[model samples]
Target: MGDLKILICVLIFSIKTVHSTKSKPHIVIIIADDLGWNDVGFHGSNQIPTPNMDALAYNGVILNRFYTLPQCTPSRAALLTGQYPMRYGYQGIPILAGENRFLPFQIPTLAKKLKELGYDTHLIGKWHLGQGYRNATPGAHGFDNHFGYWNGFMGYFNHEATGGNMVGLDMHHNDEPVWDTRGQYATDLITEKSEEVIKGHNESKPLFLIVSHLAVHTGKGGVDLEVKDIAENNKKFGYIQDERRRMYAGMTDELDKSVGDTIKALAEKRILDNTIIVFFSDNGAPTIGSALLDNTGSNWPLRGQKFTVFDGGVRTVAMIYSEQLQNKGTINNELIHITDLMPTLYYAAGGDVASLGKIDGINQWLTITKSEKSQRSEALINIDEARNVSALLTDGGRYKLINGSTVFSEVDGDFYGETGRDDSNPEYNTDDILHSSVNILLRGNLTQEKILNLRKQMELKSCRKSTIDHDSCRYNSVCLFDLFEDPCETTNIANKFPEVTERMKSKLEKYWSEVKVQRKGFLDPNANPVYYNNTWYPWLEDTRCHVGDLRTILLS
Candidate 1:
């Protein structure tokens, strides 16, 4: 009788443990570096075939109005820390190698918060937040395991920055320089490591994996490093004419394949259905005429590109895939910000939101899963500190106001270099493609017509437009646009509605002041020890590099 009772107790305990493990969803966040709004196939890109990304979106919910910061460092910083980057002194700037600027360890990151809830956190690419200082790397920031480069960008093949102020091998595996990964393309290497992590993940605990790809971002070798072989891959991308654009297409294709492989790994591990995958670009594409590396990523139909506060720079491509999502093969046109991810994922993992302390991110699990409308009806602010430009999108991305100017104006052309929008193409069937893809993925559980009806039932809610001209808005004047009516910021109506303009302007000013005060007086990057030492890797004290000597630093 004693032995029988013990056996029954053990069985019951095992069952409860399995149930607990299954209840916690695994989180996979795959971020693309500098991927344009039109870079992927799902976004109506005729040049690049991003089938994997398309498939994921098809089988999940597309965040139609997702917004990010104007630059990589700020966007990433906000995504992880759940605060506006400006609040932390990131301020819409890339963390240049050797700079002491980094996401401070004191701040609670998404990884840290999730890890506290018994999840295994792993960051498997681009940790550009900071590098020179100790505890500035991903490992120091609550990630249990991290593999990839610490700098913003590196040569895809050589794993080194080519001709930058911090040119050196930037690849690392858990804070240590990984020299053996030289000659391996960064995308492939990251995918391989990510699969290993997935396959080897302990199923008893939930997993939080961040596969941040460096693809689509211009490598250290510039346009040449954008793709493996421009000449060879250009043949595959015969549809794309321009050499640089063709290279961009090739790189995007590789990124798509990487996404597909990641999903496959998750499915093989039997964790796909229990995992929530969030995919998005850090920011908009860096098109030609922009000061940043012009990879020729087209943010067409939208004005401006990287470094600007325009929708083209701040608005981005984003999607969330999970079996738990109530709306699959559908677009959630809510105004979702990057900061929301931390709280959303934390809540989905059953973590107490109140315990996260003061964070800018809000729990959008219900909004994301279609259980309820988005609670975020307030203005979403985007600031470019370097340019002193700020944009505000309010009322769920319908009304837009900008307090600064944009460098690039809207361009009219097809991917084949044909001038003007192709009227024949008309409206791209994003819904149809997503529905079909999801139907296939779900094994025809949802018919095309059923999916169409579902979309209609959740018809995209309309928002009012506020338009303003770029030229007139350049010198601190407010530019207003009705983003819903004009997805392209073609017209500005700031003069039409004086009261609305004043209201938004006042709000923008108040928000900016609040953010400025949160800088904590750590505003100057030049004051860092690395800037004085003139070394990208301040931890490498033995390296022969000196202050005020750019030539020696580059050579070394």
Candidate 2:
């Protein structure tokens, strides 16, 4: 015990901390659903204007190599638990609506850890982790308050979700069905709710809020895309010819509004200077010709789409904005995975990172704030035995290996997006997209010219086009590439680098062997909302415990 205490002190004082606030730094995580690499303005997309997101990125450490699981559930599981979802087996795929899978209650979540330090934890939208069993809900996982749907995606206005045609109203405030706010756009409601939480927060206790948004994700059924003020959106995005893409632009615009509004609320509460706002997409966009949920967001210049292990799917747009960092307004190309969030934020909130027992995440608090070397080297992109696919990012992200490719890989492997928008790809140069607000929002340390040069220096440099054969790969195939030179993943070097490929394959096998839990989500008739008062509610009995005989004593 004495040794542990001394070690904790050593770790705490080993490097300079971000800030020493009167209160613990407020932690806010803003998630964008199915937002693609090319979807945001910061990522060099001119098709849509994301001035607010760009402004925040310009001010913060723009994450040049942020990696996530190529799907929703696994990525989220990693972030919350600080462990790869594969250990307890939620990594293979997303929980389809009405599926009986949930992250095991035994695993302590990020909210639970923060709660241990007296944080007021709240989840404002999209709790897709679990819903069938009460023990699997957000309340059971440690969030003090949860407001939103339990399904993967829902109608922005109606809030009706569908899982293989099992459709019903999904909006809920805690465990109860909510109906009063029907016909309201989800983006507006989500933004409003987040602002309300910030405004109403006691502030005596540090705030740990997760604004898990539903924006930019395709909504339910045929009316999949919902935007607030479509008439106004059409005029704003009339330049983009595709109707669906135009609607998507409007949805993305709404998402930016959420980001801007949340930051404003934090500033208004006098916590902006002491707040750490983490923003990133849960996964890459499901572009046209992708395997599932074909939303119109683009991952152009990055090969493949959602669910594929290519850079487009796993390598996502991410940034960390905080007034705490001394190193500001530059891109950090360190190897960072979604799982790192747990220890990173927990440490930032003053929790002992050493006490976060047996997690896959590496503590990067000092690295990000001080521009030191990242603690992680290799990252498991994904290992889904169900999909018969797996991938690994190894050699400090210099090499990548993908085995058992999905059928849609060939189709999605091609760089996808409207060519008209690609003329002045933001990667080409930063002449047009820089908003004037960047200088003001950047905490005043960096001049506009210095910030621009930093942006250029850290930008993802485009390589000479490699010929990508669309018809070559079929069904499943093992492919390897040197990711340092090939971020787009156009060439497969598996044969050229046999030794590297085998080593990575061995690493993946070890992780798969460590997995002790696996759950598959399947359609069920009983899960339909008609049986549960026309709303999705818990139906399964709690599987959190087993029956045991009571202890007894007999007197002579």
Clashes of each: 11, 0
Query: Which digits, one per residue and each the tens of the lDDT, describe model 1 over residues 1-556?
Result: 5574355334433432233434899999999988887665555444565656766766678888888887888889889988887676666557666555678778999999999999999999898887655578887888999988887788889877533433567677774667787888888999999999999999988999999999889886544545776668967866555767777778887898788778767765767668899999998888764357677787655666776666677778898988788777788888889999999999999999999888878889999897478877754556655456778877777888987755334321111121212452233344444333222333324444644454344322222124434365564667788777866676778889788788888878777876652232222333223433422343433333334654355446
Question: Alpha carbon lDDT of residue 390, candidate 1?
Answer: 75
Model 2's TM-score against the true structure:
0.89
Candidate models: Cα lDDT each? 0.71, 0.78
- Candidate 2: misplaced stretches above 4 Å? 1-22, 407-412, 419-442, 445-448, 458-461, 464-466, 471-475, 541-556
Q: Model 1: which ten-residue window has the lowest total lDDT?
A: 411-420
Q: How much is 294 displaced in model 2, in angstroms?
A: 1.3
